[model samples]
Target chain A: DAGITQSPRHKVTETGTPVTLRCHQTENHRYMYWYRQDPGHGLRLIHYSYGVKDTDKGEVSDGYSVSRSKTEDFLLTLESATSSQTSVYFCATTGESNQPQHFGDGTRLSIL
Target chain B: AQRVTQPEKLLSVFKGAPVELKCNYSYSGSPELFWYVQYSRQRLQLLLRHISRESIKGFTADLNKGETSFHLKKPFAQEEDSAMYYCALGDTPLVFGKGTRLSVIA
Candidate 1:
């Protein structure tokens, strides 16, 4: 287990509202990722950060955005929440691509 | 596109029985394969990787290039081994399978 923590472990928000989930790492790894876990869909990458002020959209980045302004913090935000956006979110980080990515516990978010 | 496939959604076996969790992957070039496990109320953690060639807690995964598979096997499954197991692929950002839940009964 790596030193990763996700803020707001559980959240319930209404549709049309804005929400942000934060991931903080003490490992100082260069790569960071945000993924959403749904019942039959597995874990789909939503967004990832490679460096400070650098980020990339992943396969399922439709309604989410991510930012990495500092070494220890990575943020995933939903501009406007929707019911479809509800899922268990995960954060991971690694020193490089082929290395094992350590994961945080998870964040359970529900939008009603 | 890179993808991982885990055929079984759930499996059950008695303690001391042999266990196998199948995983297949698709990618253009050489890829790194891994198995991650999560117990109840615990974070997902790495179990093993193809590159390491080492077994953790009596579990081993062999990466077969021809079949594009990395299957986890253990001679005698323990009740503690019961958990949700995920197969993932990477050379870059990872792609994961839906995961298989193993239930071991005493």
Candidate 2:
């Protein structure tokens, strides 16, 4: 276990509603990442944080934002959810770039 | 941009048989390869990395730069080894493959 937990394991919401998913870790790793998983596409990066208040966009960052106020918590938000935005979001962290990452259970979000 | 590809979507083998799961990658720079596995109803977890040059759960993968492949292999398969396996590349933000589901039947 990497001491990671993602809140709201399952959620269903309507389009145009704002949604936030929380990822909490106890490992105090320096890197945190948010990824969305879909059939045939595998896992695509959404956003990542190298440190507190330091963030960057990934391959699929449009319509999504992330925040990292502390080393253990990274939050991903969708300003306005859409049906196309529905996906299984996974949170992962690692001590350094070369090391293997540890993943959270993931949050299943559905936008109607 | 780096990309990882697992050509096989599903693989099946009997217990005690050797198993191989193919993975290929495309990257311009030095590549860092890794294999991650997700068991039934379990969170995804790291299986092994090429940098370590070590085996996990009796499975080993060798990174072949010339072929741009990092195929995972094991001498003997067990039912417990059944899981979804993904191959990833890069250091910071790894690019993942679609994943292959391996089934080890008794």
Residues B9-43 of candidate 1: C-alpha lDDT, one tens digit per residue: 99999999999999999998988999999887577
lDDT of 1 at A53: 95
Query: What stretches of model 2 exceed 4 Å from their correct place?
Result: none
| Top-DockQ candidate index | 1
What's the lDDT for all of these models? 0.92, 0.93
Best model number under TM-score? 1
Please give, for residues A57-89, the per-residue lDDT of candidate 2 as tens digits: 999999999999999999999999999989999
Which pairs of residues collide in model 2? none
Q: Candidate 1, residues A1-112: lDDT per residue as tens digits?
A: 6799998999999999999999999998999999998877878899998999999989899999998999899999999999999999999999897788999999999999
